[model samples]
Target: MKTDRRSVIIGSALAGVALFAGGTLSAIMDVADARADPSPEALAQAGPLGDVVLGSDQAPVTIVEYASLTCPHCAAFATETFPQLKEKYIDTGKVKFIFREMPFDDLALAAAMVARCVPKDKFIPMVEMLFEQQKQWANQNARQELFNIAKLSGMTQTQFDECLKNEEIAKGLIDTSQRATKEFGVDSTPTFFVNGKILKGNRPLADFEALIKEAAPT
Candidate 1:
């Protein structure tokens, strides 16, 4: 808790620190290691990637999801289908879930990056909030909406902007989605890879259950 609180203070300072002149460069350097394509030296100092995993890693089923923060169908799945799936399979140690970003627009990418800026453990909850409130945000006032959502995790407006402005993270998201498109033919939101079988769009709970049952390790 102490560490997280301190991080909020430091992270908020990052937005305005560039105006300080004396500490601006040093502040940038401090988070430089967090850049997506950092050198090995920087990688050594890098923070958590916020790629949260649920259930045991050794679970029989592995579900990898590629979704966008601003996608309505993705939110539908999160709000409706996912809970049932999580309750029946994921929470029972039968499935290991991994979420990957596939942001389709500037606003989606910004939301994704803001989700990444928080403490790693808070990543999934932040994602849930964004998805649950997808209709409320994803507007002309998206930046403000995103800030309101991000503040639940202790992010200030300046920190929220700073997180979105990090090109490395933004580029990394683009690169990831592009790779998914070229290699895996992923061009939409709520694409799921259930033990290698690709299921696209918002699938109902029954569809996911059947898919999981078929793909789940015996």
Candidate 2:
């Protein structure tokens, strides 16, 4: 929270990378270059399924997350803390969960595209697999490995290719990232909005549980 927003986000302890669909290609996008406020019209726009949301729409608390697939902290939360939160909160309709793509780079953007291409019902599961096996599909020889994971989500290679190359999908993801930066000052991965309160970085499950308990409608 001290450094320049762009520097803060781009300089997170990003410890890994991922491969894109069909392999043999990669790109690095600097988050700094993605700085801009959307126009009023653009502000009203949204991505596929308006980004993945779960739990009852009537849940008293809404938790919105901005995460980058290549981010280790993001992966840690997904692996260690998310399940407990999901079990105690989302699954019980105690909290409405929203997961938005805040891709840290082009490879991440590609992964995000694949997640979105999945069936809406399968989105969370697909993302869980991506984070769970991140090391497998986040390297130079990740084409086939990624395909295997995509297959688990019912995405064919043809669909995978089409998805990575889809301009609209790419733009939608970019817009989501840009809005996160512009509106929320999201400079790092695993940034959580707990009932509209910003919780940056990878906080423990207990900490989040407390926030949920405090925010839940009485």
Candidate 3:
């Protein structure tokens, strides 16, 4: 298949990043036990693309997550830990969850773009599908594979292609990532800011619970 402007968009976005061995999963598996001081003001700063948040706005605790689409650790958290977190915290209005894109490769950027193209209400479900079916699609034939996934959400082939070629969406994701790296020292996939306290890695749900409890108001 002939490449399209989507390729150019990916190339432009990943220009400086090392394309080492065709961008193997860059997610760090075992992140060190580390945390950063809370930056509530910085965490509250809105991105250009705007946030698709989950749970009540008045929730006591807030979680801001920056994850890559192609990261296995991120998939693990999304498919496994996130459900429990959503059930116990988000659904209960105890925590507000915010997901931000931090694409690690060209494929990841493409996936994030497609996810953003969907209606705002469908964003979480679209991301859930991407994570659950990651093994099937995150490959050399990423374009077709991602289109297949998008189709499941009623997205047409034209929409899929258009989403991939959308430079504004692409740039928004890249800018979000750059700001994350600059302001929060985010260097790995699945990095999170729980009430503005940075936590790295695909930690167990218990780890999240502990932080959320601490952040919860007395």
Candidate 4:
């Protein structure tokens, strides 16, 4: 198998740093070479083209989130921090929020597919359900976990199976996600772009509050 390009470059840079400290020429050369290389397909899978729009197209602040359903950090953010932000900013018309799927594993991809099955109006709620039950679906050994979650979301078994088997939808999702990663340089889950400023990781409510305050209308 071909080694992932990003990993190779990253490993080379780290080894150079450790093995040649004193600002050596060889280390500098390695760093330069790594810089010339592009990231791998995995890193390039951030989102789709035209998927992100700044500010409600009207709101002062736009929050675009690239997240994985099975990621514990993402679940924590959704369950703990998002509600406050939604109430204080999104609901108040001060901010517009867009969620893009970033699948970290097969389970996460499955969850993303199920979330997309719901109508656009129920998209956020279905997303919340997936995050809220991440543990149940993520930990279960059976593939039926996805089906079970789908049923809870009002999908019959046949519908769930058909949706899961819909290769076109899956490919479209993957393509969109890839476009997002390539365009936005998204390397990790739960990455947020608030008014185009990147915020990585599962941050506390205070951080969001500060950004919202900064972006709030005068």
C-alpha root-mean-square deviation, each candidate: 11.4, 6.0, 7.3, 11.8
lDDT of 3: 0.76
Off by over 4 Å in 4: 1-57
Which candidate has the top score in lDDT?
Answer: 3
User: Mind sharing the TM-score for model 4?
Assistant: 0.73
lDDT of each: 0.66, 0.70, 0.76, 0.61
lDDT of 2 at 90: 88
Worst 10 residues of 1 by lDDT: 26-35
Q: Candidate 3 on 143-179: residue-level lDDT in tens? A: 6788788887889987876676676887788777767
Task: Give the lDDT of residue 212 in candidate 1.
Answer: 77
Candidate 3 regions with alpha-carbon error over 4 angstroms: 1-35
At residue 195, candidate 1 shows an lDDT of 69
Shift in Å, residue 76, candidate 4: 0.3
Q: What is the lDDT of residue 85 in candidate 1?
A: 86
Clash-forming residue pairs, model 1: none
In every candidate, how many clashes are there?
Answer: 0, 2, 0, 7
Model 2 lDDT tens row, 1-218: 12243543321111112233233333333344432322323333455438577889788877888888877888899999888899988898888888888876556777877887888889889999999988877776665776788999878889877776666666677767766666656777888877766677889988887777777746
- lDDT winner, 2 or 3: 3
Task: Show the lowest summed lDDT stretch of 10 residues, model 4.
Answer: 25-34
Residue 29 shift from truth in candidate 1, angstroms: 30
TM-score, every prediction: 0.75, 0.79, 0.84, 0.73
Residues 1-218, candidate 4: write the lDDT tens digits: 01133211111212212222323211111111211112333332344322432234467777778787777989999999999888877777788777777664445666676677766666677788878887887785435766676676678877766665555555556655455455555656688776666778899978876776776747
Error of 1 at 83 (Å): 0.7
Deviation in Å, model 4, residue 185 alpha carbon: 1.3
